[model samples]
Target: MKTYRIRKPKIVVIGGGTGLPVILKGLRSESADITAIVTVADDGGSSGTLRSSVNIAPPGDLRNVLVALSDMPQLYEDLFQYRFREEDEFLANHSVGNLIIAALSEMKGSTYDAIRLLSTFMHVEGNIYPASEEPLTLHALFEDGMTVSGESKIAKTRKKINHVYVTNTNNTDKPKAARKVIKAIEEADMIVLGPGSLYTSILPNLMVQEIGEAVSKTEAEVVYICNIMTQKGETEHFSDANHIQVLHQHLKTKFIDTVLVNTEKVPENYMDTKTYDEYLVQVIHDFKGLRDEGCRVISADFLELRNGGVFHDGEKVVEELFRLVFGAKY
Candidate 1:
């Protein structure tokens, strides 16, 4: 029998929030090696509550990432994602996975270590890393020259977001990326950012000094999966180009080589306001501006309407990604 060396393309995805996991789950079905670098600046709900009392980095995003990559059965994954209802008092709105990660963090001495242990035990198909080992506070500078701090708070205030950055909760100390994160980026064949909230979820991870620098300097094909809808607080009327511009401004470079955009029309008055109210409008497109920033745009009807809400078609998105990775003559 002849053994052939099959090199799986190393794909590193950097972002947090619910969107990251959708793409990860789709990618899990493909033949690429994946590494997810998740943001730790989540200051909302179970994550925020835990961060406030325990001083561990919020485990919400990390928990979701671990579950997405896990090859475990649906029942186990559901158990991990189970959340206590509002009437539960002390445990109200807390996810079972968040509690598990918190307990593991306490046992192992750090959130990064806890994630690694959980990843192994869950038989996670890919590596999931927290952007920073320590808890971080997100500070956003609004257009009015006023700065608001905290991820949850920023989302509630409908201010014109000037820019956002992250700071270690330990005063002036700068946060550092784990060694594995840097290595993964350095060795990646393709690096993907977003499909998540631009400022809150995606930028938080890139703001980490070393990780940002590594992404800026990496030789891989950097693809950005632009969000399908405009968010109210952070990006109310942002064009697709505006989103890319903001990312470029934050990273201090036009590192994006390709942009995947959704061209499907969202039916007017379709999204249920009471449930998915955070979404404001469909993102407008500016192909010229995207080209000006030196990006090859690949626009498609990547929409999936379910539960009267807007979402990226994960299977379609994965198809495009596969074409880029395996078929592109780059």
Candidate 2:
């Protein structure tokens, strides 16, 4: 057994879906305390179905994060991830995990309580909190006077996301911070935002009024991990600085102390063969230019994922993050 060492720095991660979980898996080794603030605006597929028909918090993203942090064997994780395959009945497309969470919420009398119960069963290494307690919606306002609601739709539209807000702007049921989550942030030596989708995975948590305000006021050194490639439509031609610019525009405050960018380039051969190759994006990341704007851009070896997809090397990325946090001169 690889004995888990405990660095236990209070680390608060704000995002939703696959990206945050991958980061959690890497950071687990650093012994830093971890908290995940996940977005709950999903309104598509099994998540949307449950939300519309059953009036429960969307469970897909939350389930993914839970599985990511779990110490349970792959069998249980597979069961949690199993989606209906045979196309016949009411449960056809829904995930078993989503139903389990919904059922647990009903039994426990609250979604938050149900999550705690489920996490305990899974032996999740860290805490996960929804941005808000209520069954809420995401509203997207595009520059063309068009409006879209729900996380799924906005994600698919391929349009420039102008701004976002919760549907019930007046609702104030900030999900009580998981005791450990707040403590993680308060004590975290560093907090990282991204390598995730800009609008969907990254900004959704930040859109929450209370969470955003708290992040702005927190003293942890904030780092924005810039994505290596841009998402089509949302961040076409966007550079490292462009990503931070969009974030600052949305938040209306400057909370980011540093931005980490990939200094290495993708292998030309691989880039030429990927699907949608022409649309392959590169960072307009100029360190001097970012330094001029008063944001320090830390360059690292952020490379394309091995075996095909475009993503950062998880171990390498997190290792660099460790160095940056502990003030390694690298």
**How does candidate 1 score on lDDT?**
0.90
Model 2: per-residue Cα lDDT at residue 207: 72
- Local lDDT at 200 for model 2: 71
Clashing pairs in 1: none
Candidate 1 lDDT, 1-330, residue by residue in tens: 211226677889999988999899888888779899999999999999998888899999999999889988999999999999999999999999999999999999999999999989999988998988889999999999999999999978899988899999866888899759999999998899979999999999999989999999998889999998999898998989998899899888999999999999999999998898899889999999999999999999999999998888888998788778765433
Off by over 4 Å in 2: 1-7, 86-88, 169-184, 268-280, 304-307, 328-330
TM-score of each: 0.96, 0.87
The top-ranked prediction according to TM-score is: 1
Tell me the lDDT of model 2 at 118: 90
User: What's the lDDT for all of these models?
Assistant: 0.90, 0.74
Q: What is candidate 2's lDDT per residue for 165-205, written digit by digit as tens?
A: 67542355553433344555666677788878787777777
Model 2 sits at a Cα RMSD from the real structure of 3.4
On the 0 to 100 scale, the lDDT of residue 208 in model 1 is 91
